[model samples]
Target chain A: MSRTIAVVAAGAMGAAVGARLAARGARVVTSLDGRSEASIVRARAAGMIGVGDAELAGAEIFLSIVPPDKAVGLATRMAAAIAAARTRPVYVDLNAVSPATAREVGAIVAAAGATFVDGGIFGAPPQREGKGPAFHLCGPVGDCAAILAGHGLDAKVLEGGVGAASALKMAYAGITKGLTALGAGMILAATRHGVGGALLDELGASQPELLARLAKGIPDMLPKAYRWVPEMREIAATIGEDRPESAVYTAMAEFYAAVAADHAGEERETALLMRFFAGRG
Target chain B: MSRTIAVVAAGAMGAAVGARLAARGARVVTSLDGRSEASIVRARAAGMIGVGDAELAGAEIFLSIVPPDKAVGLATRMAAAIAAARTRPVYVDLNAVSPATAREVGAIVAAAGATFVDGGIFGAPPQREGKGPAFHLCGPVGDCAAILAGHGLDAKVLEGGVGAASALKMAYAGITKGLTALGAGMILAATRHGVGGALLDELGASQPELLARLAKGIPDMLPKAYRWVPEMREIAATIGEDRPESAVYTAMAEFYAAVAADHAGEERETALLMRFFAGRG
Candidate 1:
């Protein structure tokens, strides 16, 4: 059966995912209002039909895909559209936000007579790398991943419902992206001491694996760090206020923000890290 | 002209450096006062002459090598000996203390009419590593590196005076050891999210070098972490407050303290990290 799906905001992951479903013969629709020309083009190219609120609520499912900061606002919009049209579509949130945010979004949609499924995308979109994205799903309808798998997504239903999928994503990103900050901090600190070469050499000799990871990861993080700040904040909020581990993620948020700061506020650590790589290259 | 040297508290680094000088025919005298039996054995094995206060003051050079916490106390003792005998020895403090602490020690020694040189040791004692103990020396008499270089030590004299040598050590250690704490924090956090193996796999795939570093460094840090606590404190003090970078070193100190704490405290982080390695092996 063809699934009427509304994929909101056709960004990198969203566009690719929308395309995957459209190609699988699902009736994929999207709202590109107030979107950039680039985003509109992406949505059109992905075969996602442009829609107003009335058309949006006609879909069997509404997938929320946006930045961490925008997740709540987008879910609220979907809830209103569903309420106005007197239709109850399953709304799945796939944003990189905290569990608390997910629960809040779940309530917003539920109050609007819409079914809510919590989702956390583990890998890249299916259209990217020509592979199935690992859609870790939780909540009552969390097995929505199974439905997603029909379009070739690698769906995994977590036994722990509701916040499970979001928790998984937050924790995973906290480690992967968090590591880049750690590597950068240490490398620049070593450079300050003039033992930059010595430390790198020792790591190369004794911790060769770590040396390789830093070489790749730190450089990769430089351009994308701006986008990671809010995600780190979400990770911090998800972990809550009490645990000491909360400090680690919160510190990462500050680290990324510093890296993204302007030239006058140019982070000493960031400058040194850039210099280290520039010298190496 | 052969120089007379007094090496106080012949521990790992002290005994090794003293032996290097003694083997080259320098008169290396030491005091085992209030030292452990192990330390006495190490001092004797290094062929150092046991000395009282009068003999200590007679030496042309006195090297104070101890833990970061003990650096100031040892310097105070050296100052007293110089004051009591009314004789001056060029006192070199080579502990892994903060620059501020080093300056305080330098002042204590210099007040008694003894010349003070600041020193930072980069590598382990030759007894452990067999070579390449880059003794970075600073201060007005920093050329004191020339004296130690004769005994086959790899000594480098920086252009900067006082504080510089200690600053180098603090900054260097802040990164090397700090990175270990960061890695452990992330790895254990990932474990809490039930994605420990997943993170390890992802790291192995994308950050092979980092994966390798975490494998070795985290495990190696276990027993020695208890010792690293004070060094982290010194690094934090050296970086001081009002800078974002200082937080990294401070967090590392807390991380080490948690690891050194007992099991009842349930250092979930420490256990996960240890388990990761134990399972790997």
Candidate 2:
């Protein structure tokens, strides 16, 4: 059975995942009204049909893939179109937002008369990696995951209501990204003290695998740092402000913010980091 | 020719490393004047000769292997004795302290007419593991490393001035212990939000090794959480409070402090973590 699927915004993950569905004979429609030329090109290349915002509600399934900061805004933007449709689509939010934010989005979508699935995507884009990332879904998932899995996506239903998937996502990312920030912060501090080389040397001798991971992960993080700021804050929110550990994510947000600024500015700290991580200044 | 080496206040690491040195024919001396009975017993079992504080300066080499909080106070206490001795021993401060703190200790030792070597130990004690940890040294080391190396300890010299070794230690511990705190924080948060099992499931599927590390580390961290408080603070001091990342160590300190309290109190959080990590609620 061919399903009418609307993948909004046509970003990297969206376009890639949409291509998989389209290739598997699903009619993947996307709204590219305000997206960049690059995004339009990606959507077109991925065999997705472009549609107006109002037409998005006509699809049987709606997948929202956007940045953490934009997750709420996107849900609110599509609420009116979804409410006016004859049959409300199963709307899935697959952004890297906290459980709290997921619940908030779920409420907005449910109020608009759609069955909202709280979701989180793990791993890289399928098109680029040649392997699809897992799509974890919660909250009255029904046949939505099966539908997506039938179209070549690795969609799985997690046990719990709305916010379960996001909680897992927040916990997972908090460790991975938090470690990266800790590594970068300590390495930079070591460099400032003129012992960066020694730190790297000791790590190479002692924790070689961890050193290699930081080497690879830190550079890969530079471009994506701007997006990570809100995601870190989301993790902080997931942990809640009352907890002492919440401050870790807040610091990570601030650290990423600094790294983003460093990357955008003269690239002084970025170059130092690149030199340390990638052996290039 | 065997050298006389003084290893102060025999804690776990001190007694083990002292045992290794003692076994290898270096005369290991320690001051048990104010140490716990357990410490004194360990020192004696390690074959370390107990000497009065006044006689500690008479050894050819003095190794300070106390906690980070006690490093400076020990040095200050021993300064007058070192100054009054006929021939001052080469003093080594091997505690986990900030570079700033290391330099401060260096100044105090140098003022007492002893050649001050900043040092840091990596790895577990030799007696427990049957292998020695690396002893990284800086500042006019001057046969201090060679003396330890000759006695079966892996003593290596780092390049730079007084603070190099401490900087490396601070950086390394910051990453290792900091990651442990971050993992514990997120897992506890997930458990609080009723998604801990889901988080562990996802981690097992994606990051098995990291999950295993947390399972082992968070349990191991409980007993040592009290000691890590000062070490984390030293790392925060090393990073400098002006930097955004410094807050990470502060948060880690606070998190560990809370965990320590939890471990001491009703053990609610501790039991939850143990159930998640060790399957023993």
Candidate 3:
């Protein structure tokens, strides 16, 4: 039996996820309300039917796949819409947020009589050749991964509830993206010291593997720096308040914010970093 | 002609450096005023002739190689002693300190009629391997690297004066030790989330190079974590005041402080991290 699924956003991952399910005979639905033209086009291309927030109650599963900052707010709004409904679909949040945020989302959706699944998506869209993109699932509502997996999307059920998948995500991203932030910070600091080029050369000569990672990571991260600021803060909070270790990610937040502004304005630092790495490449 | 030189503290690196000089026919002197029996033993083994603070003024060069906290104070005390001398030695500040502190030391020594050199040492003690441990030199008195190089030390003269070598050291150390701190912090953060074992596996599978680096770094760092706390703080100060990047090192300072204490107490995080990486290795 084909399941009727409602995907909240039709951005790259959301649309690709919908396309995967739609190909496998599932009826995919999305709300195009207040979305950009590109998003609408993507949703349509992914074979998603446009629906209203009020109509979201008709679906079997609701997957939230928006920016980190919008994760909670969207859940709140949807919970409100579903409050008067007799039947509520399971609401799954698959955003890059902290465990604390996931629990908050859990509380909201549960209050509305909708099951909440904490999810963390790790990997590219489902179009890749080998293996499905791992959509790590957790919480009381989490076995939803099994449903998505049955539909050809790679879904994984993590053992711990609510915060587990997100905790895994936060820790993983803290290393991957956090390394990028550290590399960029070092590059900027080295540049300030006038040994920027020499440092790169020296790193290549000795720490070849690290230099290679930086070379690949910097270009991949530049355009996405704006999106990463809040993600870093989420990572910081995930590290928790009791320990000062969280400040490393907090520092990363500022680093990304500065780079984001530079990338947006095409400033000198932006031009230099991109050109330096691209040239080296 | 063989030169008369004095090493301020006969600690590990200092004793080793003095031994290298003493082995090469330099008259190596040290002050054993308030050192431990172990330090006195090491100094004697290194062939360092014991001298008073008054006698230190008689040497051609006096190298300051204590901990960062003690770097400035040692310089001040030595400045007072050397001030009464007819011919004061070059009081080169060679501690792991910030450029600002290096500059402060420079002022102190210059007021005492002694030339000040800023130096940063890289690599293990001299008796180890093929290449000599590099002593990177800067500032007016920095040309003294030549004197050390003449006696088997690998001394390199950098272009910038005073703060340049220390700045280079800070930048270099921030990347090297800073990366170690970041790695340990992430490891600890991951452990808190209950996916610690999974993370190590995932990292080994995905980021093998980084995992390899961590495997090498953590064990090497665990025992030395206490010594590194102040170094992290110095690196933080070296990142300067305006930028928030310093906080990353500040966080590292705290992280290392915790790990150091854990190592001393043989606590769980310490045991787990050391065992995990050791088992992996």
Candidate 4:
């Protein structure tokens, strides 16, 4: 008997994950009520079955994969549907968020009489050929990893109850994405001061690996700058408002917001960054 | 002919550099004015000759190697002494400061009828048996590099004028030190949340290089955190007041200030960081 799983709003990551589960003999159902045509096409191509929001609660597992800002709203929606259904599925939140936000969602799921599993995904989306991303599960995961692994997903259960996975996620992304923002900012400032070449030369002679990481990261970050805005805010929240390190994430939020605006507008700054890494990369 | 170079108020870097010059047969002079006993001992051990403030102006080259906060004060004092002297030696501002600050020092030296060279140091202090730090010089640095190289220093001339070298220094330090602060903050936050062990495990599996860097950098940064406070501020100023990236340096300044305070006060936070990297390092 193929167990049914509800993967919400077929975005890039959601659709890819849905495809992987579907390919491994699982019935993947998704609610695409307000999704775009591109999302609809992705869903169909990924072999996901589209159904109404209420029908989504009938599945054995509900995977909430959405933007950081949308995590709460999706949880609220799923709670209502799960409360009305006879068989409530386990709700798994896999969005990149702070630990505090994870606990807030956990509370909502508990109120709906559904088992909640806190999860965070590391690495890129699953591909047809390559190593798949790891799904770090926390809280009362029970047999969640076994179920996820049965569907060809890489799932690892971490110690501690809720927020462990999110904390790891926040810390990891804080370093990686935080570095990208810092590199882009300083490189632009150096270029503005006409010592950009010298800075690069110094970095090559000193920290070559860091320079190489920036070359690859800054270019890769261009298209995804918009998505990182709220995510950085989430990281700030994870670090707590009382700490000085929290301010770094807040500043990074403002930086990504500016980059997103620049990427959407004339792309002047974006072009400068692309050119900086063009020959070097 | 052996050049008489005045290296002011011999601190660690100043004393080491003075020793290198003295060993290469240059006459190294310094002022003992209000320095601590430790500084006096270091200066004497490094073969530097103690002289009065007015006598320092008689040297062929004046190297201002002090803390970032003391750069302007030293330059002002040098300008006065240069104005009263018969022969105005070339004044090199070698402190970590913003481009604007460098230009300000340049103007002050020029008004006193002394040639000014804007310079910044990269790498650690020169040792007896290892690679020496590079001295980057800008402005009208005529035979300054040749003179410094003759005394066993690695002197490189940069293009443009007064602010060029300072700009390079600011950009380089901004990245290296900025990353260290970000790592320390996030690791502490994770530890506070009880997910620190998992965070390290994940980092070891994913970003092993960054983990290695933090393990070394955090411990090394303990004692030097006090010196980095003003340097981080200079980096913030170098990025200009209007940019979002400037905020990062401001936040980093606060972070280092806190670390310095913590290190001075209770051994609580400092011990936590030390233990975090103890066996892993």
Best model number under TM-score: 2
Give the lowest summed-lDDT range of ten residues in model 1 chain B: B262-271
**lDDT tens digits, residue span A1-281, model 3:** 67889998998889988888898789999989999999999989989989998777668889999888889899888987778766788888999999999999989988998988888887667782455567878877544777888788777777787788888888878878887777777677766766566567556655778778888888888888887899989988988877878988888788788888888886767767765565431
DockQ, every prediction: 0.25, 0.83, 0.48, 0.73
Candidate 4 local lDDT, B1-281, one digit each (tens) = 77899998699999999999999999999998789998999999999999986789878899999888888888888888888889888999988899999988888988988899999998889998566998999999999989998889999999978999999998888888889988888888778777788778878887888889898888889888988899999998998889887888898898899999999999678987887776321
The pairs that clash in candidate 3 are A139-A162
Cα RMSD of predicted structure 3:
3.7
Candidate 1: deviation at residue B91, Å?
4.2
lDDT of all predictions, in order shown?
A: 0.74, 0.89, 0.81, 0.88
Which DockQ value does candidate 1 get?
0.25
Interface RMSD (C-alpha) of each candidate?
3.8, 0.9, 1.7, 0.9
> Which regions of candidate 4 fall more than 4 Å away from where they truly are?
A279-281, B279-281
TM-score of each: 0.76, 0.96, 0.85, 0.94
lDDT of 3 by residue, B118-178 (tens): 8887666778345556787888854588888887788777767788777767776777777
Reported per model, the fraction of native interface contacts reproduced equals 0.22, 0.84, 0.50, 0.67
lDDT of 1: 0.74
Predicted complex 2: DockQ: 0.83
- What lDDT score is found at residue B74 in candidate 2? 89
Q: Give the TM-score of candidate 4.
A: 0.94
